[model samples]
Target: MNFFSYLASYFDFDLKILPYCIGLSLDILILYPLLTYFKWHLLSRLGVTLKDKEVIFSSRKNNFNLAYFVNKYGDRNLRIADGLSRKLLHIFSGIWHLVFLNLVIQDTRIAWQAAFVKSLLIIALCSLSYSSNKVFGLAGIMYGATSRIRDGLDGRKNFFIAQLAFLNLYVLVFIEYIARKNISNEDNLIFFSFFIFLPLIIGDALGEIIGTIWGKQKIRVWGVGQINRKSVLGTVSVFLGSLLPLLLVVSLNNLPAEWWLLCLSVAATTSTIELIAPRSTDNFFIPVGNALVCLIFAVYVIHL
Candidate 1:
C-alpha cells in the first residue's frame, strides 16, 4: 500500500475515542513544559542553586545534572527529591487512566488505542531528549525534571528506560483484554482495567515515597541503579497500599467471596515483585505479575 493509505489503515480507531485521545495528547503537550519549568523552581527551593539550574537547563548532555544535585545536596536529599518527583509523576499517570475510564471511553478496545497513542507521544518525546538539536527545548526540560539518579549519570538513558517500562504496562493490559473472553461486558472491562492498574499506581508509588522518607531498616535487593536497597517499611507500605484499594474494588463491585483471596494474593504478589525486580523494571514486572496471579485466580480458583 502507499504511505498515506498505510497510515489510514494502521490507525483504524473508533471515532468515539478519537477526540478524547487527541484532547488528552494536546493537554499533555501544553501543560508538561509548564509543569517542568515550575518543578525546577520547586527543586531550587529545596536545595538546587542558580548554577545548578543553569547546568540542568543549558546542557545538551545528560550526565552532569545528577552530579550537580549530588554535589549540592548530598545523596540522600537527592534520593528524596527524585523519589518525590518520580512518584508524583506516577500518580499523575494514574489520574490519566482514571480520566480515560470515567470521562473518555469504557470499551477496552478504545482504551488500548488511546493508550497506544499516548505511549507513542511519550516515546517520541523521550527519543527527542537524546537529540543534540536545539529546537526540542521541552525534551531537555523533561529530562531535567523527571530523570532518576539511581539509573546512573546518563539521565536521558534512565528516563527512556522508565518510559519503556510504561509502554510494557500498556501492552500487558492490551494482552489481558484480548486473552480473557469473559470480560465482554462493559463494566467487566472497566473493572478489569482498574483492578490490574490500581495496585501498580497506588501501591508502588506509596511504597517508594513512604519508604524513602521513613524507612530505617534496609534490606539489599537487585536493580540497575546505584542503590539496590529496599526498606522493610516500604515493603509493608506496598502491601497495605495494594490491599486497601482492592478491598474497595471488591466492596464496590460485589465480587464473589473468593475474590478476597484474589485481592490478598495480588497484593502479596506485587509487593514481592517490587522487592525483587530490578530497580526501575518493577514498573513492568509488578503489573505483569499482578495480572498473572489474577488470571490464575480467575481461571482456576474464582472462575471470573
Candidate 2:
C-alpha cells in the first residue's frame, strides 16, 4: 500500500477525499503567511492586523522590513478589526471543513476532479463575496459614520447589497443541488438554518452585542483604514457567543459529536468573514459563502 492506501487503512475512509483535506489544509496553512508577509502598512490599513511600534529606523529598507511582520503578529485589540479578522479566519476554516468533510466522511467515488471543480466554485463564490463585502460594507460603515442619512437610504442600500449577495448564493446552491440530483427540503432546512440564518442573525448579534459589552479597550481610531477597532475581549466574546446557537442546533438535530467540529468551523468562519468582509454586507456574503460550503458537503454525501 502506498500513501493513499496507507492512510485509507488508518481511517478506513476513501482516497478521493484526501485531495479535499490536502487542499483545505493547504489553504489554511497559507492564510497566515499570505496576510502576514505583505506590506505591514497595507495590512494595517485593511484592519487585518494591528500596529504598535513604528520603526524610526535610519534605513528605509530596515524600517519597512521591521514593520511588516509586526503588523501581522501584533496584539489585536480593536473590536472592528478583531471582528473582521475573525470573520475571514472563520470563512477559511469553513472551507477547510468542506475539504475535510468531502474527503473523509463522504464517499470516495466522488472523483477528485469533481471535488476540485466544486472547491474552485466555492472559492470563487467566496472570493466574490469577500471582495464585494469589503468594498460595499466599508462604504456603508464609512457612510454611516460620516454621511447624513435621515431617510436611512444608506441603510437601505446596505440591505439591498447584502440581500442581492445572499440571493445569488442560494441561486448557486439550487443550481448545484439540482445538478447533483440531491436536492431535498430536508437538506434545505438544515442548510438554510445552519448556514444561512444562523450566520447572519446569530453571528452578527454575537459580534456586535457581546463585543460592545465586553470589549475592553476602545482603541482610538488613529486614522481611517487602520485595524484600530479590534479588541481581544471583543473577539473572545464574539467567538464564544456565536457558538451558542450552533451548539443548540447540533443537539436538536442529533448530529454526531464530530458535527460539532463542523459547527465550530462555521462559527469561526462566519465571525471572521463578518469582520473582514465589511459591515452589513456579510449579511449576504456570509450566507453565500456558507451555501457554497454546503455544496461541497453535498458533493461528498452524494458520492458516499
Candidate 3:
C-alpha cells in the first residue's frame, strides 16, 4: 500500500488512537523546531552562546532556504517535493517510538513487522530527500561523516545523520519489542514508556534549557575525551530530567515508593551516557541505559 494507506492502516480508527498519532507527529515536526528556535533566541539573550552541542538542530526554514544557498550551489531553481514520503518518515519513526508507549498502557505486543516496515521506509524516504536536496559544494554530507554541526544539515547526509547515529537505539527498540511479545505486565510496559520518553524529551529539554540559560562552565565529556562542548549544568539537567519522571511514576504507583535509589541510578546513568554520547546520539544512549537500569533495579532493589 501507499503512504496514506499505510498510515490509515497503522492508525485504524477502531483503535481510536489517530489523535495521539497526530499529536506525536506534530510534536516532532512542529514543536521540536519551535523549541529549537526558541532556545536559539532565549540563550542568545542569556549569553550562553549555543555554538557547540548546545545548538543541536537547525531551523527548517534556514535549511530549506534555496535562494540564499543558490549563490554557493549555483542552482538557480530549487524544489522541495515535500509529501508523505518526506513527512511520513518523521511520522513513521514517531509512531514506532510510541509502540513502547502502547506496550505500557494497553499491554499489547507491538506490530513488529509493520514497525520494521515503517523504519525501513522512513530511512529510504530520508535518503531520497537528502539526495534530491543536495547542493554541489555540500554534497559530501550524503555519507554522514561530517564533524562540523551546521555543515552536516546542508550536505547530502543532512537529515540522515541522526538516523545513523542512533543505530544502536533502533536495534535496542526492536529487541525490546520482540521481548515484549510474550510478556504481560501493564506496569512494566508503562515503565518502559517512561524510561524512553523521559530522557529523550525531558532530559533533552533540561540540558538545552539549563545549559543555555544558566550554564557558565563547559567540560570535556568523560567518554568523549576530545569533545568539551558539554557543561556541568547540562549534565545536571539530564539527571533532573530523568529523576522527575521517576518521581511521577512512583507517585502514580507504577513504581514502588522505594524507587529513589533506582531513580537516582537512572538519572546518573543516563546523564553520564548523555555526557559522553556522540552528538545527536543522546536519544539512543539515554533510553538504552535507562532501560537497563530500570530492569536491574526492578529485579534487585525493588524485589529485595
Query: Could you say which candidate leads in TM-score?
Result: 1
Residue range 1-304, candidate 3, lDDT tens digits: 3434443443343334433434333434543344334433433453434442232222232434433433432221111111112222333444445654455334332332333333454466455544432321122222212222323333234345555544554445543544344344534555556665566656655674465346653574432212235668878887897688777876787556667677778778888887777655665667677777666555555653
Which candidate would rank higher by lDDT, 2 or 3? 3
Check candidate 1 and list the clashing pairs: 223-279
| Model 1 alpha-carbon drift over 4 Å, by segment | 1-17, 56-68, 131-136, 169-189
Question: Distance from true position, residue 200, model 2, in Å?
Answer: 1.8
lDDT of 1 at 184: 31
Using TM-score as the yardstick, the better of models 1 and 3 is 1
The estimated TM-scores of all candidates read 0.81, 0.41, 0.56
lDDT of 2 by residue, 199-276 (tens): 655566556545543665464322123223444665565566657877886788786565566567666777666666
Q: How far is candidate 3 from the true structure (C-alpha RMSD, Å)?
A: 10.9
- lDDT string for model 1 (42-142, tens) is 66777777766555544336446455556767766666766676677677767676666555675555666777777777888767656542323766555
Q: How many residue pairs collide in each prediction?
A: 1, 21, 4
- The local distance difference test score of each candidate is 0.68, 0.44, 0.47
